[model samples]
Target: MRKDWCEARKNDPTPTQMYYAKNGVITPEMEYVAKVEMLKPEYIRQLVAEGKLIIPANINHINQIPMAIGRAVKCKINANIGSSALASDINEEIEKLKVCLKYGADTVMDLSTGGDLDEIRRAIIANSTVPIGTVPIYQIIHDIKDLDNLTPQIMLECIEKQAKQGVSYFTIHAGFLLKFMPLVAKRKMGIVSRGGSLMASWMMKHHKENPFYEAFDEICDICAKYDASLSLGDSLRPGCLHDASDEAQMSELAVLGELTKRAWEKNVQVMVEGPGHVPFNQIEFNMKEEQRLCHDAPFYILGPLPTDIGAGYDHITSAIGGTMAAFHGASMLCYVTPKEHLGLPNAKDVRDGIISHKIAAHAADVALGRVGAIERDHAMSDARYKFDWNKQFELALDPDKARELHDESLPQDVFKEAEFCSMCGPKFCAYKISQEIAKIECNDYPKEKK
Candidate 1:
């Protein structure tokens, strides 16, 4: 096995501090990510110092590339593709990963819960050029013959194994302590997160403290050594609008707040993951509370799906919530597929989910005044006005799909003469009529009635 990069750098201050203490020094990772994001190094450094952003670059994971998550950059989108015990096809999962990447996902998480968890994780890490994140508790719980078999040592071993495999970040459900489990027992969804549910069940069954929470500092030490970012999981996130912003959720968030501080102190990069389902009215409050409570660590959120009724259209619901969440200061939007609350997402569902979240991320970037957001929109509008079909297709979030749909709607032969599209046809082409009127009015007008 390779030596841990973070352990080699452990004698030095943390990456954030390294940036803050600087005399204009920049790491290669910082420079590369800055160029990709079109932001200055100093600006990125400032956000890091303020604890409003994170890059999740594990030193051990040399193959793991860097991407910024913060207010100052383009909002980032994360696509989750993984297998479960009930359904584990490694090749299908890889195809889904490709689909996400092709559709413009900024990051990917392998939430696989079956089929040689270690092998699946290692395969993903090897194939992924972008940072890969995982929930270590899944493996821990999956390995147990009985729920009662779970212990702190088993959990830590799983985390260490993944860390060794070069997982850049981990969604440690350390916030789900025994003290907070009772609060969630009365929740509407009652622990919707798989990791959360597993831990909760283990704690309730054994009548013991959550090992992850009880040994958080130890977990931090291990993570810091590997330079893996700790994504403090929201074990009690509201699973439906009815449960949005309830006491149980807030109670777990309070624990996450304290844990966030601890992780930062250990120089472990940290982000807070949030809600499963939240109403439109409450999304802003949830974002604000997360920033306030988590000390402004980068906020990663799931759909927070505004309503629970859109079973087949949950992607739309998630995008709606995601746009609001991002605009309100959520740093990362985890794409939710139509299969949400239904079944495992297939490749098409993954693509649809990624494209929807991409739209939400870009929309939020435009709203937040990020560097290139509005310019792209204006460029697309120009393409539309000029009837530049190629340019318009190129500007789309999913260019292939856009072009395919355009072909289906209007074949090339039909519009060969005029710049008008099939949607308007020849008789009612608004642009054509507007142009004709402009020419006639300009040429036939009488001296402006002077």
Candidate 2:
């Protein structure tokens, strides 16, 4: 279906959504997003034209379903699943992708640094129904083992190669400037971002500016050709609580802001990536500052884990910060797994990560009162009150897990209509008692004389 749509727009020099929106032409993608967001197509076009929202529907990614990411829409979630140099492979990554989609991940980034890079990415993109993103530098770095052999031309080629292969977006670490090195040197956890560290290494070794920044225009041209979006990577994002909202992070953000305008000038879509870790109190500031600095180009953020102590449960920590981040202004939340800072995640880790972020995103949407957001919560409440076990399970974010927990004690079909769960038996069930009290007639109670 999307191939047919792309075929019709092949004559346009820049077929990007931004181009269409700016020209007062509403594409089918805009209408699709409008229906999903419950807003008018004109409103979606207006937001895209102003660079506030992005619909990452790459022309080459014909199988992809269009999704809108912006402060005005329901907060989205991204699951990072890929093979490492030491563990995982294409099949495992694909399985992880299935889990991601099954659990409601809004986007998926193929961060595979191992196996056959081209084959792995091709397989992932071919199979993905959601927008697929990649950090082009990973494959470039892996293909060229020696940093000395890397060139700006090589970087552009990698980006173009991936874009041609139907990658919906690229996380370009172009905003990390050489001037920020001095500030990074004073940080507690200096340069936690993988892309940031790689850029910093190249800059320090060459004693020159970041190559991504230098060739950003050419990269934008590639994106415009394929209607791919640029997620300007926050290479200087804080990696720890002490480094949260520091000078280095803010400086890189300013560069991202400028890059956003440059990308927009070329009629390319853009979204700005944000922090790695941030304190609870600082999440709001980080979110708002990104909107202010990046001109509302759909801020996408990582866990921004509120604390540094959660080793095995960074997903939970990230959820805590993610809720606050999305509630404030973040358009998308990147899931963090239990193996974060420990090891590469497995399929189960991906599931846990996706569910955690989904909870966070939905909680934020409910808090913000987005259209129909609270309806699910009300339905869940009604189900619980009526002892509708099946309804409650159906309403749960993870229905299988919810049913698993409930069936741990009473796995029989008879318990499906029970008024109480494992936590409270029928004798002590409040809902059951309330039902009994409501059944009594008003005449049964003694009344005082007026």
Candidate 3:
């Protein structure tokens, strides 16, 4: 069934069906995703028309399954896993991928910076069932002998290579123009994104235009050919609350607005990647600006980590910001693990990051009134009210952990037939007292009335 859907997307009999989205037609991919999401086909089309939902299905990636991102559907979560130059291990990275999948990550990005980049990417692409994304600039930087040797052509070639390798989306830092460099140079963190910093350094050394900016249309053509979606990266996103929504970030955003229109003109799907570290108050403004300026392209964000502190607990900080961001209009969240600032995350960190973002996504979905979001919560509430421990555990996000925590303080043997557990103990249990009071009132109400 999946094969037929993918083949039809590539070779549908319709004459002008270049990309499924360009023809103003609904393809099998759309139908499949709509069914999975429990949304109507026309609603998916409407969101795609407004540039709110993005379905990243590359023609070459026959194994690629379709997923939607927009206001009308459940918010999606993405897990980023890859080896760095300082530390590289293929097995460990694969383990992280397993953890991401196990914890329900909607998508994964192969940000591998070391250990035969091509091999690592191929392995990840082969292993991933969900849509995969890549930052092409990372490979271009890793390949160059010296930073000065990098050129626009090298960067463009990297993008093409990855697209052919079946990357569903590409994070092109085309907004980091040479003109925006001076502004970043004057900032506290300079450039926070690795790709953004590399481009900035290269532009400064050569005094030339940003290759991606200068060749934006050509890049769009490549994306259209493969039906690969473009994730317009925020090269000037604020790295701290102090730098939130400044002129530099807004200037790059303006450029992205122009770029987004150009991509749509070529009939290519596009999304905008947002901030690094924004405060709680500014997340909504950032979301609104992306929607207004970029013509409502799906807004994918990285933590936007409300504050700079909480190194070991950045997951919580990110979840707080992520919920607000999604509620305000962001569609996809890039999970930020505990080791965000310190180092690469292990398997446990991946699970923690995905779970945190999953919670944020569910909360936002409920607020948005997406189907089934509230139903599960209501079911869990009913189970709790009935004192049904088994049902409660079954409905929990982390059932194993929930079961373990319940067993820790309340031994099953000691409280075999009791209606309450420890923490309040039997004497002080509120629910038990309430149950007793309800029975007494029921028995005395008739006699008192007589």
Strongest candidate by TM-score: 2
Candidate 2 differs from the real structure by a C-alpha RMSD in angstroms, to one decimal, of 1.1
Q: Per model, how many backbone clashes are there?
A: 0, 0, 0
Model 3: per-residue lDDT, tens digit, 1-450? Answer: 356655554644321112445546777777877898998887777667656788886766667667877666788999999999888888888888878777789889999988788888877777777888999888887888577877667777888898888888999889988877668767887778887887788788889988788889888877877778899998888888888888899999888888988887777788899987998988899999988998888889998799999899999999999999999998899999999888988888888899899999899989988888899999998876667777887888777677788889875754534567667777888877877877785556656545
lDDT of 3 at 54: 81
The residue ranges of model 1 lying beyond 4 angstroms of the native Cα positions read 1-25, 413-418, 437-443, 446-450
Pairs that collide in candidate 2 are none
Worst 10 residues of 2 by lDDT: 417-426
RMSD in angstroms, candidate 1?
Answer: 2.9
Per-model CA lDDT versus the true structure: 0.81, 0.92, 0.82
For 94-134, candidate 1 gives per-residue lDDT tens digits of: 88877876888878999998788788777777777778899
lDDT of 3 at 4: 66
Residue lDDT tens for model 2, 333-365: 999999999999998999999999999999999
Q: At residue 332, what lDDT does model 1 achieve?
A: 88
Q: Better model by lDDT, 1 or 2?
A: 2
Question: What C-alpha lDDT, on a 0 to 100 scale, does residue 147 get in candidate 3?
Answer: 78
